[model samples]
Target chain A: MSVVIEAHNISKRFFLGERNQRAFFEDVSVKTIRGLRRLARRRLAPEQSSSRDFWALKDISFQISQGQTLAIIGENGAGKSTLLKILSRITQPTTGTVKVYGRLASLLEVGTGFHPEFSGRDNIFLNGAMLGLSRKDVRKRFDRIVEFSGLAKFIDVPVKNYSSGMYVRLAFSVAAHLNPEIVILDEVLAVGDTVFQKKCFDRMEEIIDEGHAAILVSHGMAHIRRMCQICLWLKNGRIKMLGPTDEVASCYEKATTHEVVAHYEKQTAEQHGPTHPSAIAGLVQWSVQSKAASAPHSIIVSQAKVTFRFEIELTAMISHGKISVSVADAQGLILFTQQGELGQITRGKFWATLELPFLPLKPGEYIVTCTISEADHPVAFLRATPELTVLKDESLAQSGYHGVLNMPARLSVEQIPQA
Target chain B: MAQTSSAKETRVQSVPEIVTGTNDALPSAKPTYVVDADKILSSHPKDLWAYRELYLLLVKRDFVAVYKQTVLGPLWFFVQPFLASLVFIVVFSQIARLPTTDLPPLVYYMSGIIVWTYFSNSLSQVASTFLSSGTIFRKIYFPRLIVPFSQISMNFLNFIGQLLVLFGVIACYKLSGHRIELSLKILALPLVLADMALLALGLGCIIAAATVKYRDLNIVVGYTLNLWMYGSLVIYPRSAVPAHLQPLLALNPMASFVESFRSCLFDTEHTTVQPAVIATLMTIVIAIIGIWCFAKAEGTFTDSI
Candidate 1:
């Protein structure tokens, strides 16, 4: 296949002090005085730290062939948008040249280059032209664009009045009908409701099938896994890994999962200030921990105890108290509960531990809830939720493993039963 | 192109056509693009020509959208020039009693204000191109000239409206026993209008480009235009200007632009050949410089804006 897009040695360096806004007088005069100061400072130090240089992208190079799609996966600050802006020609690369071989249309953002004041009909022509299509081309596909957006009724209405979903649909519809040889999409698929997202996916698949080269910046592994042939993993603006989509996706997943270990203090809003005068004790902090409270990211396996530690601040004194706990999935479905038991309590700080054992849950995320009470009367009730995750055990067969259950099971099929 | 070259940062110090120069093995069926470390000039006039329909649509957008919301609609267009002319008649003729070239004060000021409004409108619109279009510029890339060009085009549409009103006023003045003769120099009205547009576009693009970094130039532009109007002898005829300063003020391209434009309507002295010729030449030079500045500004502007 012929290469449709090629980028060589693309590096963009931005000045730290450079600001983008300029109204007439407000910025100009200040900028002028500052410019002179900068000149003097440059003469004195030659490499003033005030005029710092930031390399958004450094020595990046890639090429995409016809009908091939590359997924660009990275964290938020990994220069994904910068690379797209350079490739889309919205901004010039500081020290590189990007030569697109054919007509290029970039959906860098939804409703980008759209005029909200313009009616949908007018915006179609304007947006199409901005995307390098001529008026005749936009006219030819006008009905199709309206139909694809399912916004025929609102085509004459100004886009400002559109719900965000409607605006995204129309914008995507225009981009979907683009016949350019190369299209660049930047996280636009993560928009609209599920049906529209599905349409976006289907339209993208259709575009790929039509042999147009594409470069997509997205975080959705399912979409990337389905549509992308290759992937480029960016870490701090450098290519960390680049190869087959499945392999790179797995690498990214592994890296992210292992790196997500965090220490979190469950400080509720009311717990931060003074407790009620009548209250004897209040919850200070609660945490869900793994091993020895060093890290919290590890997944709990089947039938293993996961630690839930709670800290309480006693205002005056309490004769006896009991703590109740409940665990719920993300959808608020209570999966486990521990009834309160009376215990002797005193003034000042208090700490307690609850280990949830035999959590017969599948590999999914769950949250914990806790409350404190005395004599069946609530003194300080904490409805705060802390989250925990459970990973599937490798020993279990990956069949009938949907929903929130991982019960032990034995299966056998004997031919003698039929005889 | 089907070439097996290693992917490396070329750091193209200049242009990178040499990459293709060495790639003799590349398949001719495919096209290739090499991104270079250097900035490339991208103001292809042909690209603007190709998007002509978009240009007209945008002009329509500027014209129709402005009046789209107003209850009076396009009558606002006539209201501005008319009121300005009426003010000039009251101020310049009644109070100051400025010398005139044997034409009715209303007709004389109408011609001058008509020409001046077109010139000022084009200049200010083009001047604000960077500020007004910065949002569109950040989100999309097109021929950057289109923003300034569309401003001039929109002003031209308003000029047509003003021109019709000028004809109506002249016709009315002729019925009121005022002698107004059509000078053949009126045939050069198109040339005069071109001069106005070119001068505005040239100067406006420079200001637009300059205002990107040194925005104080915007204030300077505001003051300079007011001064420039006085320098152009728009209210009074050229004969009212002292002979000593006549030659110096004639250096202002707009001086001759306004004079020649008014000379087309006023049956006044047709001695505008020299100044008009000088202004036309200066307009071309200014336009060349303007385009150069604008081209240089467009690439780096995204960084600042």
Candidate 2:
């Protein structure tokens, strides 16, 4: 396939410093004072005069062949939009070059270049012109644009008078008529009604079928997976991976969960048994451990046997004791709950452990709750928290099932004789 | 061989690469456009030419949109300059005792009002080019000069409307058998008009480029333009100035254009060729610099904006 676009070693640096902080007029007004300050500071330490730089994109490179669509996926500040801007030629990279062998049209924003006071028809011609189409070209596709927008009636009315819905429809219809060989789309597809979005997808598919190339920046994963053939996963302004969509997508998903785990870990505080000795003397030690003590509970594989252990202290004698263990998911939805009666405990300290043969949980972090109270009276109690995470890597799950239960389904193949 | 690295493109053969037809090996002669930091400072004239239709369409937008919500619509175009001329007659001719040349105060002030209003209004539009269309600028890439250039097209329509009123006033004089005559200098009308436009465009481009980064210039420019109105010979004839300040007054490029416009109307012969020539040369230089600064700021404006 012939390459339609080639980008090489692109980097964009934004100056962000005391001098850069002030824009044009502010810079002029404050120059004398800043100059004076600079002179004094330079006499002491001259190296501090340098302006700090924030590289929005760093040494990025990619090639887009005809009929290929590339998806750019990243966390919010990962330079996805910056790269889009560079590709669209709205901004210049600090260094490097980009070559495109086809006519290019970009939709970085929904109806961004529309004149509000213009009539729908006039805006179509104007926006078309803005996209580099001649007046004749606009006239040719004018009817199609009107028909697609369903704004045929409002074509002569000023767009300011049209409802915003009608405005977006007309803008998008004009944009859809572009027959350029290379298309750059930002998240502008998120606008308008669902029908418009579907139409946008269909139009994109039609363009790709004609062997035109597209570079897209969208956070919608399902759309990315469906529409894009290749993916660029940007992390902190650098390409973390550039490969087939599925490969990069899976890696991105894993990284997202890892971030979630890191965020969840900060909220958890594991305290040793007795911080408040006088406050609650009901329990001396409470912890959750693996039943076999072979695999650490810190990394619990799904369907693994594990135990919840607790030690309770009776400063005063108590009768008809009870114990309960509740396993809650990350969002605090209780997935499993178990309770049993404990006969009278009149001792200083006592240990109780509850073991499950199979965890029967999905692969995720869970909060474990243990409660001890008198059987008849629900008031006397001690509760301890131990967070649990069930690991269910495909290679780790012996039964090879992903969800809550791993049931083994027998598989046998029998060859049928040719009829 | 046809991969012409610049965008001065020939017609592209719009065939799909995947087509298994016999023409597959035909060198798909399409021009290539390479963008880098170095290209930021240079204005791509070919790209601008290709999108020239958008400029006309934008001009149409400006014209149609100006009177959009108003009930009077395009009629206000005639009313606006006439009213302003009346105000000039009342304020300057009557109260300030400014000279009205040999023509009636109404006609003289009307001539000045039409020319000055077009210049000032177009200049104001140029000044606000970035702030008004900043949303469009951030969203897409087009030649930034197109925004300011569209302002000229919009003002030109308004100028034509005012010119019609000027002719109507002049016809009344002719019908009265005053024997009005045209001078050879009147033939220079198109050149003078172009000078005004270039002056506004060049200055507007400079200010538009500056105010985007130093937005505080927006308020200052409005205030300055208002003060600048008095500096020009719009309300008074050039002779009204003292002999010592005559040279100082001539330094303003609009001085000759405004004087020449009046001279062309009444054959006052006060139109000096020297100032007109100076204004033309200054306009050319300003146009070059203005375009340079505006184009330089265009590429990275999104980051600052």
Q: Is the docking of candidate 1 incorrect, acceptable, medium or high quality?
A: incorrect
Report the C-alpha lDDT of model 1 over A61-85, residue by residue, as the tens digit: 7667667788899777778888887
Where does candidate 1 clash, by residue pair? A95-B37, A96-B36, A96-B37, A97-B35, A97-B36, A98-B35
lDDT of 1 at A92: 74
Give the top-scoring candidate (DockQ). 2
Model 1 chain A weakest lDDT span, ten residues long: A258-267
Q: A90-146 in candidate 2: lDDT tens per residue?
A: 788888888778888888776777777777777888888887788899899999989
- RMSD for each of the candidates: 9.6, 10.6
Clashing pairs in 2: A24-B213, A25-B214
Query: Model 1, B1-305: lDDT tens per residue?
Result: 10111132212122211121112233465443333456654546877887777677778888878887799988988888789888988899999999768888877787777788888988988988888888777767678888778889898888899889888988997898878886877788898999899999999988888887776677888778887888887888788888898888778888888888888766576578898898899999999899888887777777775
Taken over the whole model, the C-alpha lDDT of each candidate is 0.73, 0.72
- The prediction achieving the highest lDDT against the true structure is 1
Error of 1 at A390 (Å): 12
